[model samples]
Target: MSSEIEELRKEIENIDKQLIELLSKRLKIAAKIGEIKSKVGRDITDEKREQKVREYWYTYARNTGIPDSLVDNILPILFSYSKMVQINPGKKKNITIIGYGGMARSLASLFSLVGHNVVITGRNKEKAERLASEFRFVYMDLDSALNWGEYIILALSPSSMDYIIKISPKFSNKVVMDIFSSKNEVFSQLEKLSEIYSFNYISTHPLFGPLLYPVGERIVLIPSKSTKNLEEIITFWRECGLNTTVSSVEEHEKAMAIVQVLAHFYILGLDRSVEILKKEFKIENLSDFFTTNFREINKIIEKVNNILPVILEIQKSNPYAYKVREIGVNELQKIRKELGE
Candidate 1:
């Protein structure tokens, strides 16, 4: 090893240690601020303060000739952690998640981070255990989970929801919620089952991807007739650092038809168009020519491709899907006509 290289490595290690110490100091101060906010009955997240800090970071980067990307990438995560430390859900509850998929992990991360006792359970005990291990939570069988949990989250696919009916009195009188993307028929079915089984049923759609600890994300809540404590549920989520929007079943479904059905349908069409064009042009290395817009679009296409089954399911089940697709086709035809094609 060269002496110069070893000296540079030692310098890097010292810088890394300093960085860690600085971050720790910052978080400790943030935690103290959180304590003050709690005493005054203030919300954990102050958007104005975050924006002011972000603006200062950008100015500092500009003056110091540092790249904007460095600050942009790190600041959001830093802010999320700061807010996570600030959140103190005074009354924590037992949350049972009924799947081991991405959404299950996302919710479990948030709930467990805020001191909620979380139990991961599903038909596949191994998968449940694996997810539970990631969050330092325990895995239990469905019967035990239902009995142990105060708030039960149905995090499985819509197709797998029938499994809920298999368990009887276990879910009785519990606060049960389903986290389905589209709630056309499944929500109603779950509501009926809740009635039959005597459970409090609420339908919810998390308006974000499967990112862990989805802090500052929005969740749509559609409380059914059995969900008498809607405000309490909303308060619980707000306390956990999530913004909640309450809506009727019909309103929620209508918004999703446009948000999910129309958006995914167009993105699917765009994906196919890109693939066919790529082959026709014999462009084997598409990334070599990717512009900023193309890169962003490709990212969305990749996400859609990974979740094609869920996308297709939403397309099929959403009642306004056909109408949205028809409008999309008509718009495309108008564009082609404009180009004299």
Candidate 2:
């Protein structure tokens, strides 16, 4: 309507076009760097380099009067895309994922994106087929997939031990890995089965949630008694753009007890408390008064609720769960006394 407004809009459009062109040029250079790294056998993610780049972005943002919030939000996404372009997998292997759940889809997406041959299989053939078709992968029967795959990922939950037990005999000589959250009891069970049936069992825990193309995510790898070719397995995950950390069963369980069990326990309590307070105070439209920190906490609450079963399972299975929760409650009581509440 106004000439000044129209002129400003045109200028913004031109700037947008220039930004897109600059991004394309940057990605092209990143691809060339990826080529060099691959030739030299270097990992895709260079953490020190990433930190320097992040500092540079922040310094530039400060000099340009850009908000720290903008830098915080945009840098991770830019870094993720940069890593996605730099992924150059080596000697693709046949990966069979044995579930049609969120974690299954996430791994399938990452493996397929990195040029691996993937097959989806489970008892529910229809769900398996649908997930496979999403990534142009084939869906095979349980026995057929187990026979065909060189690496089998048991993406099912820890409660699915019966199903895992039934199929334990077929895993002979195959490199089998289970992505269970808590490994206290499950690890021992699987390790014993691996020894009995003569399979290489490697326990794994993905540190991130079910997200497609989860570049730069971290995965914890715990080796069982029968684990072999450990270096090769590490390389496989590295090539798929995941940061891998090796830990023992005890260390892994302790870490999860603090990280997952304690955190979820507090969040679940907060969620229930929030609901009780809301109903007691006759508070409606409480979101309108939410602060930025509360908004973030609410997001975590929503995510925890979405996967309540998994969260509860971790709480139940983690050996340190009782200790962690007791400490958490004691800390809250101390805070309450300090506040004179």
Candidate 3:
């Protein structure tokens, strides 16, 4: 029995080597495509082509007796790698990221992947150094980072924004951006500071979490009066495998009122209600009996709980937050009345 097991393991290892070789060939082909795309000034991601490929994979999977779910799981990873290989930045940037948090790590990972020099800096030098070491980035004091960097990303929490104002002098003539979701007062303050300090200010909200590489996430850019190289910045982000949307500060705030404010408001309320119901019903665990919808909701609830601080900050700062929450309450009340609950 041991001899048979060893023989089967050897066969598996041989297949794994063949798979690696095939993947290498695939990536080489993708690199060539990237070269051609660069010459033609085409974007790295071709969604239509990707969709066609997915459809082909689906049909091929069905015909070959392979599980459709396996194809679903593998295609996104393949697409991410394909985009990674295809993206050719016009110039390597000297990027300084403030805050050694998940978002900082995510951005640093992308920068390292795309051959950019990255510096991570914050109040906690040790934490910054730890995060920088992960991606071969430099860890430095804020003054040094600001001096060395061409582009600066403020990945700090909203509460830590005072650092920007305090160190305003270091930002002279540099391109700067903040990744705060709720723009309201913070945007105005940053814009004013940029003017006072003579720096390029572009407010940005990364419409995704701190996932590594984040190869096809959307980032909304709200250009202030001081923003001059908007097109150049957009091209830079596109080459980094991010889709960019230009929006006014007002429009961005209004949209987030609906997206973050309304959604998080209800999710928070729902989470509490779930906890209360569980206690009232004396139910200790619902995982064993969860339906697909319930499981998906549970995942969302978990994510919300983890990011509650940022959610609460958005809830407080968004101008239209109260109106949206009022609408949510009214809708829920109406449904309860109709159901006579």
Candidate 4:
């Protein structure tokens, strides 16, 4: 039995080796295709092609009796890495990030991964140096980083507007962007600052949370009064493997009202209600009875709990917040009435 187990392990090791070789060959082909795309001025990502590939994987998985769950889990990682290999940032820019927080680290990781020069700078030199070392990026003082960077990203929160105001003059002639989730107030403030500082302000909101190596995520770009070189900015984000959407400030606020405000509000209520009911009903060992759907929801609840402050800020800042919340409450009431609760 032990001898048979050893043989099986050896066979698995051999398969792993073949898998590595095939992945390497696939990436090499992707790199060559990237070169062709660069020469022809085509974008790196082809959504249609990706969809076809996903269908092929699903069909093959079904044929081989492989679980759909496995394909679902693995395909995104494969797609991300494939796009990573195909990224050809033709003229890498020096990007300076103005905060050393999670979002800053995420952007630094992506810029460094795609061969762009990134500098981490903030008031806290120690934190900046630590984050820079994680990606082998440069750690510079705020002023030096601003001067050195061709593009500047303000990764700080809306509450830090005073700090932003103080440094506004240093942004003269620079292309500056922000990654604020709620843009109603922040966008207007930044737009006004751009006019006074003589800088090009392009508002941006990264759709994904602050996860390292957030390849293939979507980022919304809103061109402000001083925005120039819009096309160049789009290409820069695409080269970093992010899908870009250009939106107006009003449109962005409305969308976030539904996407972030309403959804997070519902989840926050659900999280609190679940705990109250769990205790009220004296339920215990709930994990043992968790269905797949409940488990998925629990994960979302966990994520929301982790970022409560950001969630609350979005809830407060969206222009349509009050109306959206009223609608949400009414819907909940309707559901309760239907259930005779």
Candidate 5:
């Protein structure tokens, strides 16, 4: 039995070494992929290819008895190193972030972590002065010190994006981009300045809550028009450890309506439903019949506890959110009348 155990251990060690060697070889291929994409200036992430990879993983998981969820989360991190192997081998670029708030600070740290300079800007003299005390070369405004940038990141609110793009006066030679999650309004506004610089803009929506994520998060980039240059920039973000998908403006906005809008409405409805449930006779007077009942209630309460702030966001940004709420109210009113409300 001892000799058998020793043989099994030796086999496991050899398999582990082989796995590492294969991963390293795959990354070498990934670096080559990066070079080709970078040279042609094509976006690194192909959603179709990603979908195929995901399908393969699930199929393999079923065969190997591994849970899909566990593999899903680690999928990005494992594949992301290939992206780093690709982009990190080249010259690091300076990325300018125009805002001093949460998004700006987050991007600054992210870019800095990857050995890129993060220059920040805001027109507010007081805020800029405070920001300048830091290391990312804070400027009072764009006009004062605008040029000498490679990739300019617009990290302001959605509404503020249009105002900055049209009036900024200095984006003529830069690869200007924004990270707004919804793109209908912003993309349409960019068309007004289409002649300012042909295809010099792209809008992106990071499919993540700002503070809750790191790199390898799904980032949907809505290119103004898919061009060679825009593709290279996509590669750049992917190399920075983000999974990116390019979309038409309509596709992005419609998707957000479903993703953010529907989700927000669902949570809001759930909270309202739970509140009504709490007023029920059982909740007001718990008994032996409520063993698991209290536990379920507590779980829902926890969900709503974190949902209030998200409700605020949905009410403000998602256009489809209010409509859905209106639908729900209308249906409830119909039910009430049927029951003689």
Candidate 6:
């Protein structure tokens, strides 16, 4: 047993050294790409190139007898390497976000860690000033916002973005994105921005919950073809531990209607079912016996509970949302009939 342990430790140390050397070379290559991008005014991420790399990795993993799931987990690390290389290769970029929530804090830290300046803006001058003071970054008023930073994020609540973007025209040449859970409303406002502006407006949904990020995560991007500069920003997040993928605004809305909207409804139903079961007949020490992941299920329950009401509100407001909800109900009935119960 001692001999086996020693051999494994030696193997791991050898692998780590080789990994460091390869990573150093990879970062050098990414820095070269970033330099070329800066010169040509092109974005850092080549989506076509990323796709090619993904296929290559998956094929290599298969040939090596590695499990598909293990390969999938490694993908985020690869993207992280690409991002870390682009931003720091040993330098950083300046970034500003128009909110003070989790996404704001995360982006601020991400940009800074990569060696860039980060600023946070808020709804009021006082609040914005206060946040800036806390972060030791600059604050901006409505009239005299700084035109600094190549990237700006609108990390506002779902209800308030239209008004926010309406008056912030200084984002003219810069790339702007929103971390809004839904894309329709924000895009409607971003659409009003002039075509003459050198802007790329994309909708981003960071899939991980606010509590944990970059561990096991993916970020869905809904970008207008008009907003081509999103490539670098996407790659940046990919390195910061997000698996960035593109979806059309239409596709995002359709996918979320089911994944976000109806899935929330189903989880709510499950919670209610569990409640009724507990009230009627208690299980025998089942709660204590549940696996560790069962505790994590509580987190999912919290997520669904929080989002259920909002999705329901959207369903009430939109005709398409109503149709989608109706389909969900029909599907539930069919499921019930198909089951023996």
lDDT of 2 by residue, 134-203 (tens): 9999999999999999999999999899999999999999999999999988899999999999999999
User: Cα RMSDs of all predictions?
Assistant: 3.2, 2.1, 2.6, 2.0, 6.7, 6.5
Predicted candidate 5 versus true structure: per-residue lDDT over 1-341, tens digit per residue: 99999999999999999999999898899879877876665555566777798899899998999998788786887776765666542468867677776556656655654667556676566665555456545454666445756777788776586568665557666777777766656666664454455537777776654432245466777766423487577767766656678788777766677666665666566667766877874485433445565667656456545645644654666656567567757887899999998
C-alpha lDDT of all candidate models, in order: 0.86, 0.92, 0.88, 0.90, 0.66, 0.67
Off by over 4 Å in 4: 1-13, 36-49
Model 3 Cα shift for residue 320 (angstroms): 1.7
Per-residue C-alpha lDDT of model 3 across residues 44-74, encoded as one tens digit per residue: 7778999999999999999999998899899
* Candidate 3, residue 327: how far the Cα is off, in Å: 2.0
Clashing pairs in model 3, backbone N/Cα/C closer than 3 A:
none
Tell me the lDDT of candidate 6.
0.67
Q: Please count the clashing residue pairs in each candidate, in the order shown.
A: 0, 0, 0, 0, 0, 2
Give lDDT: candidate 2, residue 266.
93
User: With candidate 3 superimposed using the best TM-score fit, by how many Å does residue 230's alpha carbon deviate from the native?
Assistant: 1.1
Return whichever of 2 and 3 wins on lDDT. Answer: 2
Candidate 5 lDDT score at position 202: 74
4 against 5, candidate with superior TM-score: 4
Point out the higher-scoring one by TM-score: 4 or 6.
4
TM-score of each: 0.86, 0.93, 0.89, 0.93, 0.61, 0.64
Tell me the deviation in Å of residue 257 in model 6.
2.2
